[model samples]
Structure formats: C-alpha cells, structure tokens
Target: MSSRFLILFCGALVAFGISGCGAPHSPMTLALVTQPTRKNSLVKATSAKVSAAHQRIVRVEEVPNRVVTQSGLSVPRGFGVQLLAENLFVPRRMTFAPGATASQYDVFLSESKADRVSVLRVRKGRVVSKATFTREVSQPYGLAFWNNWLYVGNTDSVVRFPYRRGTVKAAGGAQRIAGLTKGGYNQHWTRNLLFDRSGKKLFVTVGSSCNSCEESSPQRAAISEMNPDGSARRVFASGFRNPVGLAWQPNTNNLWTVVNERDKLGDNVPPDYLTVVRQGAFYGWPYAYTDIERRIHADPNFGARRPDKVSETRVATVPVQAHSAALGVAFYPVQGGNFPKDYWGNAFLSFHGSWNRSEKTGYKVVRVHFQNGQPTRITDFVQGFLRRGRSWGRPVDVQIAPDGSMLFSDDSGGKIWRVFYIGK
Candidate 1:
C-alpha cells in the first residue's frame, strides 16, 4: 500500500463510519460580506466557496506517500527492521529511525511500523530525490531551517544539525541544545521550535503536562525564548494548553502562535485560537478561556484564585474557531515583485485537523489577514483535507522553501506536499 492509497483508504473508512450525517456546501459568488454555513460536507476541492481574498487558491495536485527515504548513511543496525512503506503513513504511530532506542522518544514501534522525518528534493511539483533521516531520539518533530542548519524538536529536547539547502540529505548527526523540562504524557510531549527573523533568539513551546491542572511552575504550557546558541533562557509567556505553531509576522517581526485549547469542555465551550504573543504576556490557560470580547473568562473548572503561585494572565487577541487544533504557521514573503505588497506581510497557517470534537473542524490551511498588527479576518486557503466527511490528510506544519514555494507536512499521510501559485 502506497501513501496515496493509505490516505484514501483511511479516509474511506472514516467516511463509512459517518456517511449518513450531512451534506456538503456549494459554489458561491462574492458579496459585501460572505458568510459560511456551519455544516460539514464532502465536496470536491474546486467547488468549495472558501475564499482566498485577492490571491487564487492552490489545491494539492499530487500527494505520494512513503516515497521518502534516508541518506543511505548506514543507520544503527537492526534485523527484521525493514522500512515497510505502507505502514509508514498511519496516524497513530510515531515513526523513528532504525536501531533507535524506543525509550528515547515516543515512536510507533510494533510488529509493523515505520519511521518519521523523511527527506526529499522536489522541483516543479515532482520529487526528484528522497531519503529518510532518522535520529537516536524519541518522536523527532518540529523542523525549522535557519542559517544553513536544520533544527528539530524531540519529545524531551531540541536537536540541531548542519544542512545544505536543496540537497535532501543530512549533513551529519545532531547536537543537543541544553535546558528543556520534560515529563508529560505522549500526546502533550510535542515540542515545537522556531527562530526569529534576525536569528538572534530561538523560541520553543512545551505543552501542558495534564489536561487542566496547575503546573509546577510558569514554564509548563508556555512559550519560552533563548539566545540563538541556547543561552539566556526565559519564559516568554504562559497559559496556553498547547502552543504548537510559532511564526514571526513578515512585516512587523512580532511573534504569533496557534494554540490547541484544553478538551472536555462539553465539546464546544472554548475555542482554539491564533494570537500575537508578547514578551511578557499571558493568555490564560487552565484557569480561564477566550470569551466574546476575547478576554480571559474565569475558568469554571479552576477558579482564578491562584494568581500568586500561577499567573492569571488576561486573554487578548485570538483567532477563529475553537479546538481547531491550529498547528503550523508559515509566512509568505513577497518575492521579486511577484506577489502584491500586502501579501508580503501576511501569514499562512495549517490547522492539522481536529480531534475530540462533536463536529470535526480544521483540516485545512488558512490565511491571516492583518493590518497594523491585528487580524481582520481568517480566510480558508486550502480545503479537502477532510474529504467525503473524513480527513484524507491532517496538515501538521508549513514551511517556505528556498525557491519560495510552500512546503506543507501531513503527519497523518506521512508525506510532505508542495504548492506554488501560477498565473491563470
């Protein structure tokens, strides 16, 4: 089973489980204010009325799974540990390198399982080369490129390695960055890493250890910043259940993030949000949530009495939809006079599909329309991740390649997809 078939088949299985529930949406015409119907559907990609503002929407033209491989650089020895491609793209398992200690990270290792973090060289919408770069760590996630180096975050720590751009192969093994607090369940253990535009500082996010419990200190479920070479570490902000994605605004260079809110609030009480992160701000997690005014509403679960030991930060800026599980954010810098000047400043984010919801949400990439440092609206850019009432792909992260094309990662399909705009 190739990656494509696996995605399609799993999508079909999910659809079969919920086919009799709803109807898809139809095409639309622009108006003064376009309102999207609150309903789930199984519609074709081109027919969806989701708008992209001035820019045209580019859908996925091709998605091939398990096509990525390793650098042929002789991974640690293991017998009967063949790289089975079909088992590679499943959603539940954590893919890791051969001979890697399972205890090092939370990877999917069974009689049938494959590794994550495969590499590929793509040009003109086709994969020219491929490799699977596995490391001796637990659940290698969150990849970022800065100054010819590739930084990846594992369950416990962040790893860095020298990378030659466009060469789809690892330059060498990884070096560890010190100072990260671990001890969380497997799901909340994901550590997302980001770099500032000037490369002066590195930002890392660690999710809350429990669903809605008071943390030991301020660092848990908060964003932290440090010097580029891993010095002068300090908590940037707190009160996020899971801040998975971080990006710098292209025009202002201000930091922003997409947070995954806590679950079990009657399925729709609190909404997941995207917000601008300030250096000393807090957005109220575990003790408060977003309200109509976007301020922190006192928590029905835990009252706001613990402000001394745990901070009760105010809730400010927030994005659309709750529990959307918005993960990866990528800013598209205007390149060589191709895109409009306004586009140079905007950002693109992938909501990697939602789980534990009454009705499924996210499963697509959205554009954050901003002006003077605030969002005007959140518009849909890519749809069809949730197909035929099921998710064919759950986008995890987005990155801008050296060539200016957008690279989107789907951990659900175990594949990385590329999208570029062409004049119609």
Candidate 2:
C-alpha cells in the first residue's frame, strides 16, 4: 500500500483513540456504554501441524517496509495485554475473566494472570488484529524472527514458531531449543534470545541463579551462543549477574548487553550498567561489581576474605545512574533511507527501574554512543517512568520495527511504547 493509504488505513482501524492488539491499555470510552462478557473463552490448542513441526531455518523475505510496529500491547500501565483492536497477542501476565468489558481496553481482574507473550499488529499507537498469543505457545517471552521462523524464549527453554511476512498466528509446534538451570528465587530465569546477522548463531541470556552465589559455571550469570537447533553451545561472556537485554551493533557485529546488578550494597554503591560483551572475559558478578577498585570499600555482604574471587581490577563500560536497572538493548542501524546516519549505530537501553535503592533510579531508556566500535556516550533518550523515586513502568526489552522506529516493552507499566522522529 502507498504511504498515504497506509496512514489512512491505520486511522480507520483505530477510529477510537484506543485499540488492543494483544497489548494492554486503559478502558475505552465505549466501556461505559456496553456491558463486558462475564467469562472469556479459553484459547483452544493449536493444530498438530502447527504445534508439531520440527523445522529449522525456514526462509523469510526481507522484513516488510512497514513491518507491524507493535504486537500484544498491554493495558493499565502495568497489568496485562489488551484485547481490543485485533488483539493477536496476550501478555504472559493476563487471563480474561467473566464480566470482562468488551470495550477492547477493559479487562476484568478476576481472570487475569501473567502471560508469556502476545502477538499483534500495531502502528502509530493504533492496533489491528484479533489473533493473540491467547491460544498458542506456552509462556512466550523473547520474540525474534530468523528466516521467517518466530523464536520465543520462555522461562525454561526457547521455542520456534514458523511465520511469514505479514502473517499473524504462527505454525506452532514449538521445538525446545535449550534447557536452562532450574528454579531458584534469585535465578534470573527469563531467557531472551537474539540472532546474529547471518542468522546462524542464536544468543540466549541466562541470569545468575542468585544474588551473588558462587556458581560453578560463571556462564550462570552470562550470555551464551549456539546454533538455532541448540547445537555447538559456547558461553559468549561471563560476569553479568543478570544481563537481560542483548543486541548486536548493526554494522560491526559486536555484541552488547544491559545488566541488572545485585542489590543492597547501599543506596548508590554499585552501578547497573550496559557494556560490550567480550568473549572469555569475566564481568565481576557476585565477587565484584561495576567498579573494581570500589568493591574493596563497598559493601561487605559476602565477606572480605573470599580470596578465590577475582577482582574487577579493570573498568567495564559503565552507563547511567547506579541501580537504574538497565535491561534490554537494541541498535538502530544506518539504513539507506533518509533517517540520519548518526542514529545508524546507536544502542538504546531500557532501565527496568530499581527498588532496592533509597533514591529512585532508572525507569527510562538511554542511548549508548559508539565511535570506532567502542562505547563513548550513554545519553538519556527517554525518561519519566520513575516519579519521585517510585516507578510507573519497568522498561524491559527493545526492538527495531520494520520501519526503523524503536519499540520497547515495560512489564511494570504493562505497555510498549514506540519512538520515532516526526520532523523531516
């Protein structure tokens, strides 16, 4: 469709101000006019063909010019995915209940639970689609498209769903890509997946099982890469207690991550950071933190004489304020279009926010500056999630839409916000 036609189509689909494409949102004005359904129907199991296929590396054409910008947008700032519009996806946290308003944005609380992932189509804040994650894939989290296959990372393992450009409901017999360390209170168990440029290497992040436990394999708190079929696994880097967000520099092929560090050292002792992941390099997790020398004067929680622990001795790339809880990272590539070249290789980080510190920190998105393939600036790009040290949204993962606009998720706020330039 022409650009003019596409804009009109979007506006028509969202005649009303709010629509739910699986993502959650505030109740609409119509909610007051109509009564909500008492109970929602359960999402039936998908066909065996969709759920049982064991295919790998399916071919997908280049992403559409305006690939769907939003999916499974949530509601209420921080609850569950909205069912309005053509809500194709659902939040891992919500389940519909009886008496749920049909106004698209009004979801009754009685049936709500955390969901894994939701699928939907969104653009310019409008939503389109009714197919949602409500029926397929178990607890989907990380969403990535490689060669037309949709790979979602969950708590325990990663699964693949076959999809085509402009296609919604995926062919669903999701294959288990890899198994992770089992349950633990401190285990940063959410597996977020990313693929390299050639689509050959798959990267999965497994956070530390605990705050600072002496893990036999430092990989416990690190990022790892392997084949999409779960073969030839190797630990990409170690030392991150919980490196939730992972992305590669668009041109250079260098990897980056945003780590949520351990807490309780002090109000502003150790800093949560975004840094370059070096292979076979340690990041000073339970033993050390953002600052190597300061660990000596910092909190003595684990004790002073654990002589075996390695010292940070050197500085790792550091970002914004301490305990800001930097989460997901995404690099906006330099496309051949009119978009500025300066933005081509910049990285955006979502600060999931922090609770352990007395003074509020994080809760916003920041951009990391790169020059000659090294981090030079970590500037704030989006803010206002935290108000007076309390958070309204917890920014998580960030992804670049097909149009080159940036999309990031806020689990705490239950919303996904998009960023783009309006000026020519």
Candidate 3:
C-alpha cells in the first residue's frame, strides 16, 4: 500500500481504537504519525489524515441522535425543538404582522403552492386562530410587512396591500409595484422580497432562469431594488446564481444574502455562500465560481467571457458546503432577544438540502459565528433532518420570533418548527 493510504488507514484504525499492524494502537503511535516530521510530503499526508480524523471525532461527538425531542428532531442539549404549525401547503417565507395588543403578534405565512398568505395569531407560545389573510396573491413566495403595507412578491410582480394592526383581509385593490422576469417554470422561480431599514426602498431577489446559463434578462441572476411605491426599478447587484434570503444587520445597516451557487461542478467544487450585498457588485455566476480558487469558464453561448470577472467577484463572507442549497439567513439581534447571550449577533442559515449530488448534505440549520460584525466560522446548530440517507424535512427559511426564539419553515414536511434555548 502507498504510504499515504497506509497512513490514513492506520489513523482510522487508531481513531476507532482497533489494534493493528506491528505498531500498537496507542497515543504514542498517533503522536508519531501526526507530529511534524522532516519529510515535507510525509508531513502533509500525516497532517491531512490527522485533521480528517479529528473532524470525524468532532462530528461524532457533536451529533449524537440518542435523544429525540417533541418535534421528532435531534437538537443539542438545553435546546428545545417543537412543531409550531403543520399541515400547511408548501410554506415559504414568514413575517410578523402587528397585533391588537402590545405583546401579541400575528404570524403571516406565504403558502406558495396554494398562492395565498395565511395568518395565525400567536400569543405567548400558543397559536390562537388561523385564517387566510389574502387569496388574491399569485404564486406568492415572499412576504414583507412595512409601514402599514404588506408587500407580496409573486412570480411576475410585486404588489402591496393596505394592512392594519388587527385586520386579516385587504380592504382595497392590490397595487402592482414592479414587474419581474417570470420565465415559465424554470429552475429558480421563487421571488424573495425585503425592504430597507428605513422602508424607503424595497429589494427583490430574482433567480437565474437556468442552472448555469447566461440569462437573457438582466434582472435574472440579480437583486433588483425600487422605491417603496415600486418606481425607480434597477438591478442592484448581478451575477448571483440564486440569491434567496435577504437580511439587514441591526446596527450595521449592512445588507446580507445567502446565495445558492450553480451546480454540476463536482461534489465540492463550488460552494454556496453568504455575503454582504454591495450595490452594483457582480458575483460570478455562469462564467466563474469564487471559492478557495477562482474558477473561470468560457461559454459557447457567451463566447470568451471576461476572465477578470473572476477576480472582480466579491469573496463570500462564509463559503458553505457545495450543493447544500443555502436558502434563508437571519441575524440574531442582540437587543431584547431571548436566546443565549452567546448567540447574539450570529447568523442562522437554513440549508434546504441537496438534490443532484450523490451524497446528501445540508438538511439542517447552521450558525455562522460572528466577531466584530464579520463572520468567523460555521457550526451546525440544528441537525437530524436526515436519517439513513432520507430527509424528513427540508428547511427553507429562518426568522427570529418576537420572543427571541428561532423559527424556521420546512416546506417538505409542511411544518414550521420553533427552536429556543431552555437552559440557564
């Protein structure tokens, strides 16, 4: 056997505590193999094996499915996961509408497949009543509440309806604010909407029509912005494969988004990412992928795309695992929050899981640790959505509840799950 393979084999055996080959499976054996050595190639090989073994150990230690919770999900100790609502038809995005009382809040959910936005009044931890807020929406995927108006993003246009504190139905006709590219039934047709902190501008995310092709419309593969009244429509940023979720940092005023990168680039070639959205920035889409190494491509349709585009691409704040299908991103606000103090300022992202890859990845929620308003690392916060290579739920969007708990939507299972810290 080659020395590299032998080293890995021996390391695995030692990691699993199996006695083997002339050398005893002891700490000394592990130290000898992993310690810095004179040979450069040997050192590289040994270091890789040791690192992988350490990662395996960490994964095993962190993800122990011994205890199943009320939601039939496995969560870390001191955390609680519960099904808040279920039996909905393809729930996508969720927002809190103003309630009648100070402590009460109405949760608005977009039932995408049903093309309607549903409302449920949740007081404390109980869902009081449920009703259809509006059935006038068409293939509604994103909903946002701003300044007494509820903006609904459909497949082709963004519309706004008058909203009151305690009302359920619209009193007036819907005003179409902006027109979006709705290429019939493509790979990414869902439109996500977000309003700026001041509610002066509304941002909408339009995904690329095809997986890896130059889109005919400039609006596709771009984040478009307009006045709250739906005027002054312009592409804010371009070249994103599928920018799904949009969130503004509480104090920083920085707009961030989780983008789903293109696929078919091997199992781990291109990584999906989260990054601050800069106006007019072009992220590499069909022509390039920005990762550890920038991969530039030449397309027959586009013909000799600019290589400089790769260098011009903004690097991701956090490069998530490829094919993970990162969908939702929401920052845990530090002020008046109910989560643990350590979770303050961190971002929670939902990986909608993988489809085309041979091995499944990302059927859970991950926390991106932040220090001084910048992302440091990613760690699994909620897992066990996948069991025995089968996934029971695919998390799509994540939002922070009024009480500081984390709320995420699972479209596959038609459920909304609430996760919160229960420890001191």
Q: What are the TM-scores, per candidate, against the unseen true structure?
A: 0.69, 0.68, 0.82
The window of 10 residues in a row where model 3 has the poorest summed lDDT is: 40-49
**Most accurate candidate by lDDT:** 3
lDDT of 1 by residue, 113-218 (tens): 2425555434433554446555444566566667777667766777777766445456888778755667674378667777787788888898999888888967
The numbered model that scores best in TM-score is 3
Tell me how candidate 3 scores on lDDT: 0.73
For residue 321, give model 2's deviation from the true position in Å.
2.0
lDDT of 3 by residue, 1-424 (tens): 2221112234433432434444553221111111211121111111111122212111111333335687677776778887888999999999888653425678899998898899977777677788998888888988988888999999889998898778877767688988888863235878999988788889999999887776789999999999999889899999888999999987887889998877655666467777788887777676555442112222222323554554455545556677888999999996667787778999999999999878888899987777777664456778889999999999999999888888999999998898877883
Task: Indicate the TM-score of model 1.
Answer: 0.69
What is residue 62's positional error in candidate 2, in angstroms? 38
The deviation in Å at residue 349 for candidate 1 is 2.0
